[model samples]
Target chain A: MNFDEIYSSKLALVEDALKKLMERHKECPPTLFKAMNYSLFAGGKRIRPVLLLSAHELVGGNVEESMALACGLEMIHTYSLIHDDLPAMDDDDLRRGMPTNHKVFGEGMAILAGDALLNLAYEVFLENAMKYPYKLERHVRAAFVIARAAGLHGMIGGQVADLEQEGKDVQPDMLYYIHTHKTGALIEAAVRAGAILEPIEGDVEDAVAKYGQKLGLAFQIVDDILDVTGDAASMGKNPSRDEARKKPLFQLCMAWGNRGVWHGT
Target chain B: MNFDEIYSSKLALVEDALKKLMERHKECPPTLFKAMNYSLFAGGKRIRPVLLLSAHELVGGNVEESMALACGLEMIHTYSLIHDDLPAMDDDDLRRGMPTNHKVFGEGMAILAGDALLNLAYEVFLENAMKYPYKLERHVRAAFVIARAAGLHGMIGGQVADLEQEGKDVQPDMLYYIHTHKTGALIEAAVRAGAILEPIEGDVEDAVAKYGQKLGLAFQIVDDILDVTGDAASMGKNPSRDEARKKPLFQLCMAWGNRGVWHGT
Candidate 1:
């Protein structure tokens, strides 16, 4: 498939999965669920789950087997974004061309929405494990991988570093460490989990992992690049907003021998 | 062993396990590690881990084998507390008689510390699965159970309900739902995990589950009782804080025919 075709297909699957997941929460607090759906349904690339599914496909695994995990990964990513936008965190009033969750739902409900998403992510996985016609070991491995990547030493660790480095002239190495762990870890775990579930062996697993590492870093770099160069309307969020707030960026543009050069953004 | 002796021994073991787990974060950001240590060491009853250990003992399982899971449960609980104390959530300024994490470390760092503890909790479990002397299946099952309990249909779900109900006069049924899912789920998971690892069978598992359900509700009722009756100084916090804030109380008090009576102070 062409890039758009592949991207569109993955997006459709993710959207359907998320819609179904949110439907289950219909009877939950209506306002809170609305806030959750607002952020969850907000447009994004769905890169993490797409990459996971792609990795699974590369390993000859059926996408259906990894569907629950893919959706869970996206839920986590969405939940973090919701919390990160809270006034206590980034204080952003807008995301994806819409009001941030806390802005629309009030802070308390927003917090609940983020929390609900996190919990629901795992619930989706467990339900799948209990119901899917797959080997229990695969589900167990997937669960472990997702938990590790999402938890302390993975995305959360990166987040800690990122938050800590705010308003400071964070070193390139520190920025790299933060991004690689914060975003890169989960992306890596996503791919790894997919491969592990499919029982991919040896070099293929290593190759997919390498691909994930590169893609994750590349994705973040592209985001940095976009923040500097992309249109706010097109991106559905402000570019250069980080700079406006004096937040650290992973890239630096410098002149090198009369040539413009970009360092870590 | 007598109850006190058993409790003390179990507490001691859990303390040691927590120390070991904390050591793993030594290379983490010093501020983050300090924040994490402040709360992890601030100390509560360590009741959840203690329960898990006791259950393991009752099942004839080696406490050593289940120590990691015990620590994991405590980490999860501690992380929730740290997050709950945030300005956006419960907005507390004190915990366990000391300044709350955010008060000491600032909002950003406190948030990160909570996140790190959560991630580290899973990391500890993963390490156990990899290195523990048990069958892989057993470790996987244990990890899966813990993850599910901590996720949506478990602790976080209850938290969402509790958060949403903060200002409203929630029904008694709704109150039960919140506590049972929020606090009781993990408590149940802790005991269930121990039993799972110990390979406890049939009615024994069912019995332990029933005991856990009652114990968890009783524990919450006693907490509510203390919140009303205990000295704010001795309780290390306000005793009537829940009523002052209009938060839900356990229904056990109503069962005693004391519908509107506040207990502790």
Candidate 2:
């Protein structure tokens, strides 16, 4: 299949798997279920899961075999967005052309919904890993990669740095740290996890990880550019959000005269 | 060892492991690390971790071997507390004789701190489980139990139910649902996880799980009673807080004339 066809096919698998997961949770408290469903079903490109499936497929792994894990990655991504848009965090009222989760469900339920999504991500990972006893070790390792990327040392760590840098004269190195940890870590992890889940050679795994890292950094820069130039109609949220909040951006850092060094890194 | 001696010794192991985990994260952002450590090390009885270690011991597992998983359970418990005390939730200011996480760290940091703790809990679990390749299946099972107990079908489900019932006339069945899911699920999960981590027989696991379920219910009942009857000096929180919020409690449910049926269930 060509890139678009491959991407569409993989996206379909992820969407189907996520639907099944949600159907299983239909009996949960109505508000929590609805809130989680609202944000999860919100339109966004399934980049992380697509990256994971692409890497896995490149290594001759079956897309169906790792579909649950791809869905788990998407759940984690959705949960992070839900929490980030909370009144306490970025405080955005819109996401992907819809009112934020808290706007419709209330703040308390929003918090619980985020918590439930994060927990269920692990539940999905563990449940899927358990299905293949013979490949249990690699599965555990893949889950570990995802966990590390999502935890304090990775995405959350970067978030802390970013949150602390709000309205401050952020340094170039700090900006790099924030972007890498917050965005690059998980993207790199998705690719690495895919390689680890299959019987891949070490060099190939390293190459894929490097590719993911570069892609992640570029992705963040594009996001920063879009936030400055895009409009609400296309972006589905206010474009001036980061600038309004004085949230640090890669473009701001690049203007600080470290562009060459950053590109080298 | 006698019960007290065994409990004290297991407590020491868990405490030591937790300390090491904190020390490892000292290089992370200072505020996040401090926020996480503040509540994690706050003076409170280590019930969940203690239960996990004890259950593991009862099933002939070594305390030292399962120490990390026990600590992970404690982290999950701590994260739940941090989130529960948010202004939008229970709105408590004090916990275990100190300012709550959000009270000291601000709501935004407090939210991130809680999210980090929950993520780290899974990191700890997956990391520890990966250590024993020969026994990987059981370890995965143990982590799965913890994940399920903490997820929508377990603790978070209960929390949603409780949140929805605030200031309302709650039914006994609804109260039962809240108590069992919010409080009892993790307690029972700790015991079940302990048993699963070892090579225990199936009947023993069932018996231990049943014991955990009863203990979890009794524990909630005692907590409700304490909320009404205990002093601030003892309980380390405002005694009337739950009552003021009109929180659904076991005692209130009992007063609804389902005491006999509740006990039988």
Q: Which candidate number maximizes DockQ?
A: 2
Clashing pairs in 2: none
lDDT for each candidate structure: 0.75, 0.85
How would you encode candidate 2's per-residue C-alpha lDDT over B1-265 as one tens digit per residue? 7879977877777888899987876777889999999999997578889998889888889877788888899999999999999999988888998889998999989989999999999988888887888889998999999999998999999999988887777766787888889999999999999889878789899889888887887887788778767887888886645454345564565653455434634
TM-score of each: 0.88, 0.94
Question: Model 1, A1-265: lDDT tens per residue?
Answer: 8999998898798789878867775765556667778888898778888888888887888888888889988988998888777776777877898888888878767766776677667657656765644466567567778887786667777777777776777666676777678788888888888888776667887877777776677777777777777875888776645563233342322211122112312
lDDT of 2 at B68: 82
DockQ of each: 0.41, 0.84
Highest TM-score against the true fold, candidate = 2
User: Tens digit of lDDT per residue, candidate 1, span B28-107?
Assistant: 56788889899999977898898888888888988998899899889889888888887777788878999989899988
What i-RMS does each candidate reach, in Å? 3.4, 0.8
